[model samples]
Target: MINRHLRVVLAEDSVVLRDGMVELLATRGCEVVATAGTAPALLAAVVEHRPNVAVVDIRMPPTHTDEGIRAAVEIRARTPEVGILVFSQHVETVWASRLLAGGAAGIGYLLKERVARTSEFMDALHRVAGGGTALDPEVVTQLMRGGRRGRVDTLTPREREVLELMAQGHSNRSIAALLVVSERAVEKHVAAVFTKFDLRASDADNRRVKAVLTYLAESGG
Candidate 1:
Protein backbone atom coordinates (compact mmCIF):
# COMPACT_ATOMS: atom_id res chain seq x y z
CA MET A 1 0.00 0.00 0.00
CA ILE A 2 1.08 3.61 -0.59
CA ASN A 3 2.45 5.14 2.60
CA ARG A 4 1.24 8.63 1.80
CA HIS A 5 -2.45 9.47 1.50
CA LEU A 6 -3.11 10.65 -2.05
CA ARG A 7 -5.98 13.05 -2.47
CA VAL A 8 -7.44 12.52 -5.94
CA VAL A 9 -9.93 14.22 -8.23
CA LEU A 10 -11.30 11.68 -10.69
CA ALA A 11 -12.81 12.83 -14.01
CA GLU A 12 -14.28 10.15 -16.22
CA ASP A 13 -17.43 10.33 -18.35
CA SER A 14 -18.59 6.79 -17.62
CA VAL A 15 -20.27 6.37 -14.26
CA VAL A 16 -19.45 2.69 -13.88
CA LEU A 17 -15.77 3.21 -14.57
CA ARG A 18 -15.65 6.26 -12.36
CA ASP A 19 -17.21 4.40 -9.43
CA GLY A 20 -14.95 1.48 -10.00
CA MET A 21 -11.97 3.80 -9.92
CA VAL A 22 -13.20 5.40 -6.72
CA GLU A 23 -13.56 2.00 -5.08
CA LEU A 24 -10.19 0.88 -6.38
CA LEU A 25 -8.51 3.97 -5.03
CA ALA A 26 -10.31 3.63 -1.72
CA THR A 27 -9.07 0.08 -1.40
CA ARG A 28 -5.51 1.34 -1.88
CA GLY A 29 -5.82 4.14 0.73
CA CYS A 30 -6.44 7.06 -1.62
CA GLU A 31 -9.12 9.64 -1.12
CA VAL A 32 -11.29 10.84 -4.00
CA VAL A 33 -12.09 14.36 -2.93
CA ALA A 34 -14.31 15.09 -5.94
CA THR A 35 -15.56 13.46 -9.12
CA ALA A 36 -16.56 15.02 -12.40
CA GLY A 37 -18.17 13.84 -15.64
CA THR A 38 -17.23 16.88 -17.66
CA ALA A 39 -14.24 19.08 -18.30
CA PRO A 40 -15.58 22.16 -16.56
CA ALA A 41 -16.50 20.21 -13.46
CA LEU A 42 -13.09 18.57 -13.42
CA LEU A 43 -11.39 21.95 -13.57
CA ALA A 44 -13.64 23.29 -10.85
CA ALA A 45 -12.97 20.32 -8.61
CA VAL A 46 -9.22 20.65 -9.07
CA VAL A 47 -9.41 24.31 -8.08
CA GLU A 48 -11.76 23.75 -5.14
CA HIS A 49 -10.32 20.56 -3.73
CA ARG A 50 -6.68 21.03 -4.74
CA PRO A 51 -6.12 17.32 -5.04
CA ASN A 52 -2.68 15.78 -5.09
CA VAL A 53 -3.50 14.32 -8.48
CA ALA A 54 -6.30 14.45 -11.06
CA VAL A 55 -7.13 11.18 -12.80
CA VAL A 56 -8.62 12.24 -16.12
CA ASP A 57 -10.03 10.47 -19.16
CA ILE A 58 -9.10 11.59 -22.66
CA ARG A 59 -12.71 12.00 -23.71
CA MET A 60 -15.66 13.46 -21.82
CA PRO A 61 -19.25 14.77 -22.20
CA PRO A 62 -20.45 17.37 -24.81
CA THR A 63 -18.07 16.14 -27.49
CA HIS A 64 -16.25 13.18 -26.00
CA THR A 65 -13.24 13.97 -28.10
CA ASP A 66 -10.55 15.95 -26.26
CA GLU A 67 -12.27 17.69 -23.40
CA GLY A 68 -10.37 15.91 -20.64
CA ILE A 69 -7.01 16.52 -22.29
CA ARG A 70 -7.73 20.22 -22.71
CA ALA A 71 -8.76 20.47 -19.09
CA ALA A 72 -5.59 18.67 -18.04
CA VAL A 73 -3.56 21.22 -19.98
CA GLU A 74 -5.38 24.05 -18.25
CA ILE A 75 -4.77 22.48 -14.87
CA ARG A 76 -1.05 22.23 -15.63
CA ALA A 77 -0.98 25.85 -16.63
CA ARG A 78 -3.02 27.13 -13.70
CA THR A 79 -1.80 24.78 -10.99
CA PRO A 80 1.37 22.95 -11.87
CA GLU A 81 1.49 21.49 -8.38
CA VAL A 82 -1.37 19.09 -9.03
CA GLY A 83 -0.35 16.05 -11.01
CA ILE A 84 -2.34 14.96 -14.09
CA LEU A 85 -2.88 11.37 -15.14
CA VAL A 86 -4.57 10.60 -18.46
CA PHE A 87 -6.34 7.26 -18.35
CA SER A 88 -7.99 6.39 -21.61
CA GLN A 89 -9.08 3.52 -23.84
CA HIS A 90 -7.47 5.08 -26.90
CA VAL A 91 -3.88 6.14 -27.67
CA GLU A 92 -4.69 9.60 -29.03
CA THR A 93 -1.04 10.49 -29.50
CA VAL A 94 -1.91 13.95 -30.80
CA TRP A 95 -3.74 14.85 -27.63
CA ALA A 96 -1.06 13.22 -25.51
CA SER A 97 1.59 15.33 -27.19
CA ARG A 98 -0.39 18.46 -26.44
CA LEU A 99 -0.69 17.58 -22.76
CA LEU A 100 3.06 17.03 -22.46
CA ALA A 101 3.92 20.14 -24.41
CA GLY A 102 4.04 22.09 -21.16
CA GLY A 103 6.12 19.58 -19.20
CA ALA A 104 6.40 15.89 -18.24
CA ALA A 105 6.99 16.10 -14.50
CA GLY A 106 3.99 14.95 -12.49
CA ILE A 107 2.43 13.60 -15.69
CA GLY A 108 1.29 10.10 -16.61
CA TYR A 109 -0.48 8.59 -19.62
CA LEU A 110 -1.78 5.04 -19.52
CA LEU A 111 -4.05 3.00 -21.75
CA LYS A 112 -7.00 1.38 -20.02
CA GLU A 113 -6.77 -2.05 -21.68
CA ARG A 114 -2.99 -2.17 -21.43
CA VAL A 115 -2.86 -1.70 -17.67
CA ALA A 116 -2.85 -5.42 -16.91
CA ARG A 117 -2.22 -5.25 -13.17
CA THR A 118 -3.62 -3.19 -10.32
CA SER A 119 -0.08 -2.72 -9.08
CA GLU A 120 0.89 -1.09 -12.35
CA PHE A 121 -1.92 1.45 -12.14
CA MET A 122 -1.25 2.22 -8.50
CA ASP A 123 2.47 2.60 -9.15
CA ALA A 124 1.75 5.04 -11.96
CA LEU A 125 -0.55 7.09 -9.71
CA HIS A 126 2.08 7.24 -7.01
CA ARG A 127 4.81 8.21 -9.42
CA VAL A 128 2.84 11.06 -10.97
CA ALA A 129 1.60 12.34 -7.65
CA GLY A 130 5.16 12.44 -6.41
CA GLY A 131 6.36 14.58 -9.32
CA GLY A 132 7.67 11.75 -11.47
CA THR A 133 6.86 10.31 -14.90
CA ALA A 134 4.95 7.10 -15.68
CA LEU A 135 4.38 6.80 -19.41
CA ASP A 136 3.00 3.61 -20.89
CA PRO A 137 5.51 1.68 -22.98
CA GLU A 138 3.12 1.54 -25.89
CA VAL A 139 2.81 5.31 -25.80
CA VAL A 140 6.56 5.60 -26.08
CA THR A 141 6.68 3.03 -28.88
CA GLN A 142 4.08 4.85 -30.97
CA LEU A 143 5.87 8.14 -30.49
CA MET A 144 9.20 6.65 -31.51
CA ARG A 145 7.89 4.86 -34.61
CA GLY A 146 6.17 7.95 -35.96
CA GLY A 147 8.32 10.65 -34.38
CA ARG A 148 9.65 13.26 -36.79
CA ARG A 149 13.34 13.94 -37.46
CA GLY A 150 15.17 17.20 -36.84
CA ARG A 151 17.52 17.75 -33.90
CA VAL A 152 16.56 14.25 -32.80
CA ASP A 153 18.04 13.09 -36.06
CA THR A 154 21.38 14.34 -34.90
CA LEU A 155 21.51 11.79 -32.07
CA THR A 156 23.58 8.64 -32.44
CA PRO A 157 21.75 5.31 -32.43
CA ARG A 158 22.74 4.70 -28.80
CA GLU A 159 21.72 8.20 -27.81
CA ARG A 160 18.37 7.70 -29.51
CA GLU A 161 17.95 4.43 -27.65
CA VAL A 162 18.66 6.21 -24.36
CA LEU A 163 16.12 8.92 -25.19
CA GLU A 164 13.46 6.32 -25.99
CA LEU A 165 14.05 4.66 -22.63
CA MET A 166 13.81 8.05 -20.98
CA ALA A 167 10.47 8.65 -22.71
CA GLN A 168 9.32 5.31 -21.30
CA GLY A 169 9.96 6.83 -17.85
CA HIS A 170 13.13 4.88 -17.16
CA SER A 171 15.90 6.43 -15.10
CA ASN A 172 19.56 6.35 -16.03
CA ARG A 173 20.27 3.46 -13.68
CA SER A 174 17.35 1.46 -15.03
CA ILE A 175 18.41 2.18 -18.55
CA ALA A 176 21.90 1.03 -17.71
CA ALA A 177 20.59 -2.24 -16.29
CA LEU A 178 18.33 -2.81 -19.28
CA LEU A 179 21.09 -2.08 -21.75
CA VAL A 180 23.64 -4.08 -19.77
CA VAL A 181 25.98 -1.11 -19.74
CA SER A 182 27.60 0.82 -16.93
CA GLU A 183 25.62 3.64 -15.33
CA ARG A 184 28.45 5.99 -16.25
CA ALA A 185 28.00 5.05 -19.89
CA VAL A 186 24.29 5.71 -19.59
CA GLU A 187 24.99 9.10 -18.02
CA LYS A 188 27.31 10.03 -20.86
CA HIS A 189 24.65 9.10 -23.41
CA VAL A 190 22.07 11.10 -21.50
CA ALA A 191 24.32 14.12 -21.43
CA ALA A 192 24.88 13.78 -25.17
CA VAL A 193 21.12 13.64 -25.67
CA PHE A 194 20.67 16.75 -23.58
CA THR A 195 23.31 18.60 -25.51
CA LYS A 196 21.99 17.54 -28.92
CA PHE A 197 18.43 18.38 -27.96
CA ASP A 198 19.62 21.86 -26.89
CA LEU A 199 18.13 21.43 -23.42
CA ARG A 200 20.28 23.71 -21.34
CA ALA A 201 20.61 23.30 -17.61
CA SER A 202 18.04 25.23 -15.67
CA ASP A 203 16.98 25.45 -12.04
CA ALA A 204 13.38 26.23 -12.95
CA ASP A 205 12.79 23.32 -15.36
CA ASN A 206 13.67 19.67 -15.20
CA ARG A 207 16.06 18.91 -18.07
CA ARG A 208 15.11 15.27 -18.06
CA VAL A 209 11.43 16.11 -18.45
CA LYS A 210 12.29 18.74 -21.06
CA ALA A 211 14.30 16.21 -23.04
CA VAL A 212 11.34 13.83 -23.01
CA LEU A 213 9.07 16.65 -24.10
CA THR A 214 11.41 17.47 -26.96
CA TYR A 215 11.33 13.86 -28.03
CA LEU A 216 7.52 13.89 -27.96
CA ALA A 217 7.21 17.26 -29.68
CA GLU A 218 9.48 16.24 -32.50
CA SER A 219 7.78 12.89 -32.82
CA GLY A 220 4.24 14.27 -32.51
CA GLY A 221 1.99 13.32 -35.40
Candidate 2:
Protein backbone atom coordinates (compact mmCIF):
# COMPACT_ATOMS: atom_id res chain seq x y z
CA MET A 1 0.00 0.00 0.00
CA ILE A 2 1.09 3.61 -0.65
CA ASN A 3 0.81 6.62 1.54
CA ARG A 4 -1.78 8.76 -0.17
CA HIS A 5 -1.06 11.97 1.74
CA LEU A 6 2.69 11.86 1.83
CA ARG A 7 3.97 15.20 0.56
CA VAL A 8 7.18 15.34 -1.43
CA VAL A 9 9.60 17.87 -2.90
CA LEU A 10 11.31 16.58 -6.02
CA ALA A 11 14.49 17.84 -7.62
CA GLU A 12 15.92 16.69 -10.94
CA ASP A 13 17.73 18.56 -13.70
CA SER A 14 16.30 16.57 -16.59
CA VAL A 15 12.75 17.56 -17.34
CA VAL A 16 11.78 14.20 -18.77
CA LEU A 17 12.84 12.20 -15.75
CA ARG A 18 11.51 14.78 -13.35
CA ASP A 19 8.06 14.75 -14.91
CA GLY A 20 8.08 11.00 -15.08
CA MET A 21 8.95 10.68 -11.41
CA VAL A 22 6.31 13.19 -10.41
CA GLU A 23 3.72 11.20 -12.31
CA LEU A 24 4.95 7.99 -10.78
CA LEU A 25 4.77 9.41 -7.30
CA ALA A 26 1.33 10.81 -7.97
CA THR A 27 0.10 7.43 -9.06
CA ARG A 28 1.52 5.90 -5.91
CA GLY A 29 -0.66 8.15 -3.75
CA CYS A 30 2.01 10.77 -3.10
CA GLU A 31 1.53 14.52 -3.43
CA VAL A 32 4.37 16.42 -5.05
CA VAL A 33 4.15 19.75 -3.30
CA ALA A 34 7.05 21.26 -5.22
CA THR A 35 9.59 20.54 -7.97
CA ALA A 36 12.97 22.11 -8.68
CA GLY A 37 15.50 22.05 -11.50
CA THR A 38 18.49 23.13 -9.42
CA ALA A 39 20.02 22.75 -6.02
CA PRO A 40 19.02 26.17 -4.79
CA ALA A 41 15.46 25.73 -5.96
CA LEU A 42 15.31 22.36 -4.24
CA LEU A 43 16.43 23.96 -1.01
CA ALA A 44 13.80 26.67 -1.37
CA ALA A 45 11.01 24.17 -1.93
CA VAL A 46 12.10 22.06 0.99
CA VAL A 47 12.39 25.01 3.37
CA GLU A 48 9.15 26.57 2.24
CA HIS A 49 6.90 23.57 1.80
CA ARG A 50 8.48 21.33 4.43
CA PRO A 51 7.41 18.23 2.60
CA ASN A 52 7.24 14.78 4.18
CA VAL A 53 10.16 13.72 2.06
CA ALA A 54 12.29 14.89 -0.85
CA VAL A 55 13.37 12.83 -3.84
CA VAL A 56 16.52 14.41 -5.18
CA ASP A 57 19.00 13.77 -7.94
CA ILE A 58 22.71 13.45 -7.30
CA ARG A 59 23.54 16.00 -10.00
CA MET A 60 21.59 19.07 -11.02
CA PRO A 61 21.69 22.37 -12.97
CA PRO A 62 24.52 24.92 -13.35
CA THR A 63 27.67 22.85 -13.02
CA HIS A 64 26.23 19.37 -13.50
CA THR A 65 28.37 18.39 -10.54
CA ASP A 66 27.41 17.56 -6.94
CA GLU A 67 24.81 20.25 -6.45
CA GLY A 68 22.15 17.81 -5.29
CA ILE A 69 24.48 16.18 -2.81
CA ARG A 70 25.44 19.54 -1.35
CA ALA A 71 21.79 20.53 -1.17
CA ALA A 72 21.00 17.32 0.69
CA VAL A 73 23.74 18.10 3.19
CA GLU A 74 22.22 21.51 3.84
CA ILE A 75 18.76 20.03 4.14
CA ARG A 76 19.91 17.53 6.72
CA ALA A 77 21.59 20.24 8.72
CA ARG A 78 18.81 22.81 8.69
CA THR A 79 15.71 20.63 8.55
CA PRO A 80 16.41 17.24 9.94
CA GLU A 81 12.66 16.78 10.04
CA VAL A 82 12.48 16.36 6.29
CA GLY A 83 13.29 12.97 4.80
CA ILE A 84 15.71 12.78 1.85
CA LEU A 85 16.03 10.13 -0.84
CA VAL A 86 18.93 10.58 -3.28
CA PHE A 87 18.96 8.75 -6.61
CA SER A 88 21.54 8.80 -9.35
CA GLN A 89 22.43 6.96 -12.53
CA HIS A 90 25.96 6.46 -11.24
CA VAL A 91 27.07 5.50 -7.77
CA GLU A 92 29.02 8.11 -5.86
CA THR A 93 30.25 6.55 -2.65
CA VAL A 94 31.55 9.90 -1.51
CA TRP A 95 28.15 11.51 -1.91
CA ALA A 96 26.41 8.63 -0.15
CA SER A 97 28.88 8.99 2.69
CA ARG A 98 28.01 12.66 2.89
CA LEU A 99 24.29 11.96 3.17
CA LEU A 100 24.86 9.32 5.83
CA ALA A 101 27.33 11.45 7.74
CA GLY A 102 24.88 13.01 10.14
CA GLY A 103 22.73 9.91 10.56
CA ALA A 104 20.78 7.31 8.60
CA ALA A 105 17.39 8.27 9.95
CA GLY A 106 14.99 9.69 7.45
CA ILE A 107 17.49 9.02 4.68
CA GLY A 108 17.69 6.80 1.62
CA TYR A 109 20.09 6.29 -1.30
CA LEU A 110 19.14 4.32 -4.37
CA LEU A 111 20.45 3.87 -7.87
CA LYS A 112 18.29 5.33 -10.64
CA GLU A 113 17.47 1.87 -11.96
CA ARG A 114 15.84 1.06 -8.63
CA VAL A 115 13.30 3.76 -9.37
CA ALA A 116 11.79 1.54 -12.05
CA ARG A 117 10.93 -0.96 -9.31
CA THR A 118 7.69 0.57 -8.15
CA SER A 119 7.30 -1.33 -4.87
CA GLU A 120 10.88 -0.85 -3.77
CA PHE A 121 10.91 2.86 -4.62
CA MET A 122 7.69 3.60 -2.79
CA ASP A 123 8.73 1.45 0.15
CA ALA A 124 12.02 3.33 0.38
CA LEU A 125 10.23 6.65 0.37
CA HIS A 126 7.81 5.53 3.03
CA ARG A 127 10.59 4.18 5.20
CA VAL A 128 12.62 7.39 4.95
CA ALA A 129 9.61 9.57 5.69
CA GLY A 130 8.96 7.44 8.74
CA GLY A 131 12.45 8.10 10.10
CA GLY A 132 13.72 4.73 8.97
CA THR A 133 16.40 3.85 6.39
CA ALA A 134 16.41 2.49 2.83
CA LEU A 135 19.86 1.93 1.38
CA ASP A 136 20.32 0.08 -1.89
CA PRO A 137 22.17 -3.25 -1.75
CA GLU A 138 24.63 -1.96 -4.34
CA VAL A 139 25.37 0.95 -2.07
CA VAL A 140 26.01 -1.51 0.76
CA THR A 141 28.33 -3.55 -1.43
CA GLN A 142 30.27 -0.42 -2.25
CA LEU A 143 30.51 0.39 1.43
CA MET A 144 31.73 -3.09 2.23
CA ARG A 145 34.36 -2.93 -0.50
CA GLY A 146 35.35 0.50 0.73
CA GLY A 147 35.65 -0.55 4.36
CA ARG A 148 38.94 -1.59 5.92
CA ARG A 149 39.27 -5.24 5.10
CA GLY A 150 41.43 -5.61 8.18
CA ARG A 151 38.52 -4.59 10.38
CA VAL A 152 35.69 -6.12 8.37
CA ASP A 153 37.70 -9.30 7.96
CA THR A 154 37.81 -9.88 11.71
CA LEU A 155 34.11 -10.65 11.77
CA THR A 156 32.93 -14.21 11.33
CA PRO A 157 30.95 -15.07 8.23
CA ARG A 158 27.69 -14.65 10.14
CA GLU A 159 28.66 -11.27 11.51
CA ARG A 160 29.60 -10.12 8.04
CA GLU A 161 26.23 -11.27 6.81
CA VAL A 162 24.50 -9.33 9.56
CA LEU A 163 26.54 -6.22 8.75
CA GLU A 164 25.64 -6.48 5.10
CA LEU A 165 21.99 -6.78 5.95
CA MET A 166 22.23 -3.84 8.33
CA ALA A 167 23.77 -1.71 5.62
CA GLN A 168 20.74 -2.57 3.49
CA GLY A 169 18.54 -0.93 6.16
CA HIS A 170 17.08 -4.09 7.65
CA SER A 171 15.97 -4.11 11.23
CA ASN A 172 17.06 -6.76 13.69
CA ARG A 173 13.78 -8.66 13.41
CA SER A 174 13.87 -8.48 9.67
CA ILE A 175 17.45 -9.64 9.55
CA ALA A 176 16.61 -12.50 11.88
CA ALA A 177 13.77 -13.58 9.64
CA LEU A 178 15.99 -13.51 6.59
CA LEU A 179 18.70 -15.46 8.33
CA VAL A 180 16.24 -17.93 9.80
CA VAL A 181 17.30 -17.05 13.28
CA SER A 182 15.73 -15.44 16.34
CA GLU A 183 15.77 -11.70 16.94
CA ARG A 184 17.98 -12.33 19.99
CA ALA A 185 20.58 -13.92 17.72
CA VAL A 186 20.50 -10.92 15.44
CA GLU A 187 20.84 -8.70 18.50
CA LYS A 188 23.95 -10.58 19.61
CA HIS A 189 25.49 -10.27 16.18
CA VAL A 190 24.65 -6.57 16.03
CA ALA A 191 26.16 -6.08 19.44
CA ALA A 192 29.31 -7.84 18.33
CA VAL A 193 29.42 -5.59 15.27
CA PHE A 194 29.25 -2.45 17.37
CA THR A 195 31.92 -3.71 19.70
CA LYS A 196 34.12 -4.76 16.83
CA PHE A 197 33.75 -1.37 15.14
CA ASP A 198 34.55 0.42 18.43
CA LEU A 199 31.18 2.15 18.31
CA ARG A 200 29.75 2.94 21.72
CA ALA A 201 26.99 0.60 22.82
CA SER A 202 23.89 2.70 23.14
CA ASP A 203 20.51 1.26 22.37
CA ALA A 204 19.02 4.74 22.28
CA ASP A 205 21.43 5.97 19.64
CA ASN A 206 21.41 5.32 15.93
CA ARG A 207 23.98 2.52 15.86
CA ARG A 208 22.96 1.68 12.34
CA VAL A 209 24.39 4.98 11.14
CA LYS A 210 27.55 4.44 13.14
CA ALA A 211 28.04 0.96 11.72
CA VAL A 212 27.69 2.31 8.19
CA LEU A 213 30.07 5.12 9.08
CA THR A 214 32.66 2.56 10.05
CA TYR A 215 32.32 1.19 6.55
CA LEU A 216 32.58 4.67 5.04
CA ALA A 217 35.60 5.49 7.13
CA GLU A 218 37.44 2.46 5.77
CA SER A 219 36.58 3.55 2.21
CA GLY A 220 37.95 7.07 2.86
CA GLY A 221 34.58 8.66 2.43
Residue 177 in candidate 2, Cα distance off native in Å: 30
Model 1, stretches more than 4 Å misplaced? 147-221
lDDT of 1 by residue, 43-151 (tens): 9999999999999998998999999998998998899899999999877766676667555768898999999999989998998999877788677666444433477
Task: State residue 9's C-alpha deviation in candidate 1, in Å.
Answer: 0.2
Q: TM-score of the candidate numbered 1?
A: 0.70
Tens-digit lDDT string for candidate 2 (153-217): 67889998888777655688889999999999999998898888766755443566658656534
For all predicted structures, in order, the TM-scores are: 0.70, 0.69
Which pairs clash (backbone N, Cα, C closer than 3 Å) in model 1? 147-219
The candidate scoring highest on TM-score is 1
User: In lDDT terms, how accurate is model 2?
Assistant: 0.80
